[model samples]
Target: MAHGEGSHNRNSVEAGLEARGAELTGRLIKVVLDGEALHRLSALQEADRTQAVADLEAENEFSPLSHPELESVLHLSIQEGRMVFDIRDSHETPLMAIVLAMGPFKMLIKDYQMLLDSYAGAIAEGREAKIQAIDMGRRGLHNEGAELMQARLEGKVMIDFPTARRLFTLVCALHQKL
Candidate 1:
């Protein structure tokens, strides 16, 4: 059955192409915040702020499956009181750009700053119980922020909880710059 054999071969080729396409579109290879945004992050106190930025840079990854057309590299910035996401392909081609309002994130960022200050004070004074309590509150706020981000990006992009959290931190850092 030569015709049957040819059909099977075509099907296999199409499947292979689909798989490759999926692999390419599934994940972000890297993410970078704009320089001015990073300068804002630098304004944060020396130790913990630096560590948080490092953690975000090293560990954060995004899966933009909701918008399969998005590229592998992403550039983030804050402009005119809005968060800007520039999605780029592997060859540095611009794909999609999204801007989200910053109003919803304001209170969360303020709470995060307060928690950071309290945590630092507790650490300085060697208050273990207070440190744990403050840390719990900090995490709660962080989680809430992440959830809000996910909700905001609901139809625009697909990101996991951890990615949302790291992005939230970056957004807060950008707010300080503004």
Candidate 2:
């Protein structure tokens, strides 16, 4: 199997992950359909890393797996800050729009609300549950913050002098819900 650049090479990718305190492993696979090339490389968990590989045909096109498959793909393991998939793909290039066209944008917004709901549930549980509950509440706020960040990342929204006020109001509303 051949390896690509940008955090995919076995040694470099693992080294990068180690620097960040996450341990990961690499797998390089070259798929051939009747001897024709269909390249696939996977960096999986050292133990049963095979679990990390998903069949391209089995997942929804809008799901992260297929989303990357259509163009070149990349998967980022958030916990590690290391890309599990290719990092080179991008807009105006071989970049596959995250097949979430149904809309991935809306789904991201919905995810933010889901996180808020999770926090609300925790808050209602009681002060005896304070430690864990507070943690959940913090995560809820984080989710909303992440949503705003993702919106800007996807170019679905942007910030300037005027938008900050609206953003502030949005945060207040979400906090009230929590």
Which candidate tops TM-score? 1
Assess each prediction's global lDDT (C-alpha) against the native: 0.68, 0.30
Best by lDDT: 1
For model 2, the local distance difference test gives 0.30
What lDDT is obtained when candidate 1 is compared to the true structure? Answer: 0.68
Return the clash pairs for model 1, or none: none
How much is the lDDT of residue 85 in candidate 1? 85
**Candidate 2, 71-109: lDDT as tens digits:** 223332212221122322334233332211212224433
Worst 10 residues of 1 by lDDT: 1-10
For residue 130, model 2's alpha carbon misses the true position, in angstroms, by 8.1
Put down candidate 1 lDDT per residue, 101-157, tens digits, no spaces. 988888898888777778878888999999999989977887888888877775566
Task: Please give me the total number of clashing residue pairs in predicted model 2.
Answer: 2
Cα RMSD, each candidate: 10.6, 19.7
State how far residue 23 of model 2 sits from its true place (Å): 44
